[model samples]
Target: MSSKYSLPLVLSFTIHIVLAGILLLGDFSSPPKPTPTSVQMEPIQAVIVEKSKVEAQINKIKKQKADDAKKLKDLEQSIAAAKAKRLNEAKRVKELERQRKKKAREKKAADIASKKAKAKANAADKIRKQKEREKKQADEAAAADAKAKRIKEENDAKKAAKKAEDLRKKKAAELKRKEQEARERAAQQKLLEQQMAEDMANRQQARRQQMMTEIGRFTALITQTIKRNLITDRSTMEGKSCKLTISLAPSGFVTNVVTGQGNRIVCEAAKTAVYKAGTLPVSKDPEIFREMRTISLTVAPDKFN
Candidate 1:
């Protein structure tokens, strides 16, 4: 038999033995107490006793005892078997409970592992998104900086080009003015040479030409001086001209200047320029004085005010 059923079988066998002893002892307990007796007259007769009848009574008693012992032994064996069977059922129930508890623990462990894995995945996704956002912002910042730098470079280049163009125009105008002055001087020198060679042929014509030559040279010098001092406002003096009557001393110093005719603003600008010059060019030749003193000079400019 299985070890778990051994104790219950033993206990059942002991209980059956105790019950059989109680039944046998109850049946043969000390003879019952003697009953009361009374005397009586009786007829006497001769009685015959048989040997075979006595032997048969003895054999019947022995057979009854053997059957009782056999019944008792069968009862003990049946009780023991029933008890062992009950103990086996109890063991089956306990084994099933242990299996149930083990399965429950395994399932709980699996659930915990699943939850941990899911949590890790969620954390990783959050970090990835954060890194992507930071990278996108960095890229946008770099692009904006590049755009601003390009705009600044283009503006600087435009300013440099405009400055160069203005300088080139200024230099060209200066070169043109010098060439014009040189040509005028050459013409004046040729005229003076022509008049010197023919002085005896026409004294009056030669004298007039000489005076004209002196006047032209002095006027050109005065124009150059005034041009340097003049500050023009195109809005005020565009397409305007003026005549100035100037009284000069023999020493090339101007004593007075008066506006003759033209726009008032143009005349005022011209007078201011003449005064700023402080003096006019004068010929040392006394004969040139008649035309130089109290002269009316036209102040006109085509390119500048």
Candidate 2:
């Protein structure tokens, strides 16, 4: 079946064809010749010699066939051995290829893992740096705001203090002006009071002088009335006067008469005359009449005669 056994198989087939041709063309012999000396013995002897030579040639051909078959069997065994060796070599090559592929895959996987780890580490470092920068910026902004607020508060406090001082000075000036006005008003009031007191005293002295003159005029009129009504005896009443006290009503009606130290005769006569004259002259003004309600007089009848 294999090409390596082609020549051996062709050679074996040719030797088989040659052996069949030799068996088919076996030795041919002529009929036995008759001999005169011993007729039976010579012919029999010749036939036996021919048969033995043919048998010997047949034995030689069988031996050659056996040898060729033995050689063919040995060739087939050699070819089987060579086929087995080639199969074993192919199996060894396949196993080596599988080992190489597995090692290559393992190396590729390791390289990919290393790259991924490096990328992750770089990303984490970048994020941390960014956070630190943001924190620093926030702290700076807060400090700036605090400084501005402090400055504004200081300015406001100064303005408030200055305004308060201005208000205090204005109030003090107003108080001083009011005090000066009060002192001027007090001096004017004192001068006016002194002038009013002098005018009142001068008016009172003039009123007293006028009231004294009116009182003297009324007293002389009353004495003249009494003397006109007296009963006089000139010899005994000459140079003798009578003193009398009289009480009168609001309309000048004589109520009662009392005699005081004087001439008894003239006093009796005067008392009778006053009773006869029931009414007398009186002032209509209330202040003038208060002085004449009770009056004392000395009447002398000799003067009337």
The numbered model that scores best in lDDT is: 1
**CA shift at 107, candidate 1, in angstroms?**
99
For residues 164-249, what per-residue lDDT tens digits would candidate 1 score against the true structure?
A: 99999999999999999899998998888887767755887788899999899898788878778777777777788888898899
1-305 per-residue lDDT for model 2 (tens digits): 37755766676578667655654443233224445575454477888897787677767766765665576567557666766676677788888899889889988987898799788988888988898899889889988998998999899999999989998888898888888888788878777777777777777667666666776777677777787777889888899998999888879899999999999999998998888777767777677778778888898886676
How does model 2 fare in lDDT?
A: 0.78
Give the TM-scores of the predictions, in the order they appear.
Answer: 0.33, 0.41
What is the lDDT for 270 in model 1?
81
In Å, residue 226's CA in model 1 sits off its true spot by 1.3
lDDT of candidate 2 at residue 165, scale 0 to 100: 90
* Top-TM-score structure, candidate number: 2
Total clashes for model 1: 0
